[model samples]
Target chain A: MVFLSFINNLINGVSLGSVYAIIALGYTMVYGIAKMLNFAHGDIIMVGAYVCFFMVSSFGLNPVFGILSAILVCTVLGILIEQLAYKPLRQANSLAVLITAIGVSYFLQNAAQLMWTSNPRIFPAIFGNGGLQLAGGQLMVPYKTLVTIGVCVIIMVGLILFTGKTRTGKAMRACSEDKEAAQLMGINVNRTISITFAIGSALAAVAGVLLCASYPKLIPTTGSMPGIKAFTAAVFGGIGSIPGAFLGGILLGVIEIFSSAYLSTELANAIVFLVLIVVLLVKPTGLLGKRTSEKV
Target chain B: MLKVEGINVYYDKIHAIKDVSFQVKEGEIVALIGANGAGKTTTLHTVTGLIRPKSGAITYFPEREANLYDLTKMPPHKMVEMGLAHVPEGRRIFLQMTVLENLEMGAFCKGKATKEDLDRVFARFPRLQERKKQVAGTLSGGEQQMLAMGRALMSHPKLLMLDEPSMGLSPILVEQIFDIIVELHRSGTTILLVEQNAEMALQIADRAYVLESGRVVMEGVGSELAASEEIRKAYLGG
Candidate 1:
């Protein structure tokens, strides 16, 4: 019985981790190229979830259409936010950018509240509420969990290939390393950054949909906790590394799940954060961060 | 052909370049020799559109184009598209990228690098070709300089501006780099060479300008300026 419960918790942890992984990828990529902590990224998730929720619930559209529209809306919103809010402050101090991001986050949250209200709406299931029975009904895997894990895997692979093979991807990498040098090489640095935001936001939409599907609760603040967790995952893995975010998210999710399942559910968040603090103390650069050395 | 007619640049309240002017004709190497703070790099930066001048008309006449372009109105990438390449100071090659990837970035304006472009760069620097897969940060100082030049050449630039190419290299390596510069000059590329090493720069230059405290104090033929007592006393350790 204990073994079966462990297996069940592990699957749940992985499913949750997959969602965090997808969100963390967005955080890491934006952080890598733009060199700013976009606190509003979390609010983008809220907006995306709301978009998906309205499409499916109000319009009675197919789940696929809802998901696609969510991604499209989020992508456009991401670019718009970057151009209006971030672009003007490109030359400003880092603290100014952070504050602006926070301001944007609040604006998005309040805007959602005005539109959708703070009453939590139960999210419709895109994947059917069903499960696969294994070990003679001793263990069961939900379709939602399986699909979430599969989608996350696919997204990760696709992202890796896109960045490794494409010209725009290489240019993005170049900008991340040195924007001035990249500009001199004829790479449009601004365009690359905008594209980064677009991609990050699109991924945020997918994560939002999945998160809402799994949790079955949608609200203005639905995305804040997950957004913060994913950001933590990014920092845990290595803030600017793609693979680092993935690893960090998975580990964080597993830790959170195990703490909740075995220990007190209320202490799960605190435990997760405590683990992060200890990890950071042991390795200041996080698990996979590169140690930068200045050349004289 | 390129012309800079009396450009003034300021870094905040400090005047960095004071009404500086110089010209590089087709198929010639023009050397700008100066001390650390004399603004040789700033002149190159201004020409490449990295820095905007407060007042001056910097113009470029392409080989086939009849009209002269106002370089001050263009961005640095646009300047590169117009066949000007600046091998910046300190060999700012992308450290995390491989040698081949850095060269590929140089050809970004061209969409994609043809096999010929790769061949040409590889022929010039065999070391880069051999170590093409290695990350750039792992390369030695001299190899990095060669990679920087090779990267610039990938753009097929009509005018190549090299800033302090011999910086942080051994004496023998400096000679080798100068030899490559002379070879490139011989192959019909206009060159603007900036260096603190006045002795080596003048040897391969067609015309030379001496800058002191952001002002061009002298301009003459390469060998003539090399022999001048003032230049030798100021730049060359006499």
Candidate 2:
């Protein structure tokens, strides 16, 4: 029974890992353009989940409509964060923005708790529970988990294509390389930065809705740890590298899920943090990061 | 035509440009010449809106008061929109973007670049067309210089101010670059050029301002300045 449970946990870990990867992409993309870790990003996700919960419970909206609402709201919130928090101090020290992000994160979390209450509100069912038969034995894989994994993959692919294929994508790449130069080219750099924030927040919203479906609870502070975890994924993948962020998030999720069964949950979180410390020491730029030498 | 007047600029506590003034008549090339610390760069920067002046007024003619802009105080992007484009020293191209992307970026002020405009730029610097898709940082020194000028041109400015366009090029490329400047001037683009190359600067500049320690010590027609004993011994090395 124990061996079967371990095998079952392994499958569950992969599905959960997909959700983390999807969320981490938001952190990675925003970080790539804005060049700062958005400490409030996870809260954006939490806000997303709450939006869905409110829509379904109060307005009796379809789950899909609620999901779309969550995305739209998160996108607006993300752009607002940039305009209000990031834009003014763009040329200031990175520390200023990092601190602002932390303040925003806390502010959003507290505001959320105040608005939605500190108590965990139940998330209405998006998928009923059932396990599919695997390897001749039934694995307790919820229908929600499969939907989450599928959604994450689709979003990831869409992001990759958008960033690589379009002219606007080319402009974004230009801005990331050098903001001053991009402006000289006549590109409305501010608009591009805002768009980047919008996309990143929308991705976080998707992850939030999926997470709510899996966990079935919503709280304002819910995005906090996941925020840190997604940031970790971004760093692990190579903070500035997009594909790296996605890979890092999925890897982190799997590690956390399996370790929870192998070791105590507290130990698991601690171990994950320890791994980050090690990765930082070993490769300061993370797994796929390119080295940028200082120019004279 | 562009005119500058009575502009005093300070960096921290040090005066960088003191009551310096000059002009570039239509289709003319004017050079701002000085030793390393002569505030030549600052003069260009002031005109380009990189740094604000401490005191004094700068007004253009005919529309002097009407087209009034404290050029030193405007934002960098806004300055470009006002028909003043600057090509900074050391060829500051977007290191991560391709050459084509860098060139395309120049036209951001213009609503979308036409192929003809790109062709004109490419005609001016054929090497840029060859490496349009290559990342800018990897370009050779001469290629980067061309790219820097090319980018400034993309904005279609009436007055193009360039700081040290030939700073680190081979003698051959420097001459080629000078030739291009003369060609550009002949084609009707007004230029405010700053340089340490005294000899070459005078050869093409219609007018010149010689600066020393942040103040203009000499100003005249390029031919007259080239013949001065002070310019001959100290700057022209004649």
Candidate 3:
């Protein structure tokens, strides 16, 4: 039983951890380029989940099809968010933009609540009847977990390839390092930033569809808890490091699941925060982050 | 192939460049020499579209346009697309990206850097090829400067504007950089260079302009400026 449960927790952790990773990519990429923390980022994910739900119920589409729809639509939403919410106030101080981001986040969350109501609408399942039983006290690993992990892996790999191998990816990296310099080099910084938001929100949309499929619930505020958790994972791994965000998310997810299972479920979220505080205390730059001393 | 006429630039009433004017031929390395805060950089920035002058005419080629471009009104990104490459005061490479990534960014204006272009850039800066996979921030200052130059070259610009490329470098690296600049000019790249090191700049430039207090104090051939009393007195540690 202990072995079985441990395996179950680990499997569950990977799936949940992936959600954090995908969501954190949105935060990390935007921060990398804009030097901004899009506080409204989580709500973007919630909006994605809601859109997926709408696609399925209103259009009688498969959750997988809904996932793609969510991704395409969220990409537009992400770009719009940048063009409208962030771009207009870019020249303003980070504090001003920060406040605006929070305003946007809250606005989206509350707006979704107003439109969708506080109730958690059921999401149609895509994994089919689950559970592959293993030896000894009969541990069962759900098929949904496998699918979730697969999707996260695929997206993560895709992201890494895009950033490492593509021209636009290189442009994004350039903008992140030095926006003024990137601009001077002929890269369209504004367009690159918009593209970044689009890609990031798309990742969040994928995460949303997965979450809805796995949990079978919907709410405008659903992305709230996971948003905070993913933020924690990002900080724990190293905020602007894309690969670091993924790694951090997985570790945090595993830590969270085991703590909940072996200890108290109520202590789960607290443990994640505690780890973040501890990591911050030990390494202010997070696990993979490097210390940057300001050069005049 | 470029000319500036009576250009005036300001930053909220703090006049930066006052009636500054200069010119460069189709294939020439023109040096702009000045002391700190002499508005040399401001003039360069204005030309590069980072700052626009309040009133001036910057005519390129045969000087046929009706009114000179309000460079100040143009964005930095547009400047590059127009075939101008500016290497800023600091070597601003993407620190998190690799050497390869930095070079790729430089070629962003051209869309895709052909294999021949990559090879040419690599040949010009072999050190970059050796450290293509290395992260930019880890590179030494001299290497970073080389990377900056290499990155600029990747844009395949008709005009290259460099600001204080020798600000901080060992004497050997400084000499090497000057040698490279001379070679770059010989290879037919038009250069607009600003330097505090008047002696080195004069030695490398075909012609030179001496700026003081936001105005052009003197202009002459490089060798002639190198021999002038004013150039010897203020710069060259005379």
Q: Which model scores highest in TM-score?
A: 1
Q: Can you write out model 3's per-residue Cα lDDT over A3-30, one digit (the tens) per residue? A: 7678888988888898888888778888
Which pairs clash inside model 1?
none
DockQ of each: 0.66, 0.40, 0.68
Instruction: Supply the TM-score of chain A against the true chain A for every candidate structure.
Output: 0.98, 0.94, 0.95
TM-scores for every predicted model: 0.98, 0.89, 0.93
**What local lDDT score does residue A53 receive in model 2, on the 0 to 100 scale?**
90
Candidate 2: regions farther than 4 A off = A1-11, A127-143, A165-167, A293-296, B12-14, B58-74
lDDT of each: 0.91, 0.82, 0.85
Measured by TM-score, how close is model 1 to the native structure? Answer: 0.98
Rank order (by TM-score, best first) = 1, 3, 2
Better of 1 and 3 by lDDT: 1
Indicate which candidate wins on DockQ. 3
lDDT of 2 by residue, A93-168 (tens): 9999999999999999999978878998988887766756666664566788788878878887888788765667
Q: What is the lDDT of residue A198 in candidate 1?
A: 100
Off by over 4 Å in 3: A292-296, B62-70
User: How are the candidates ranked when ordered by DockQ, highest leading?
Assistant: 3, 1, 2
TM-score of chain A of 3: 0.95
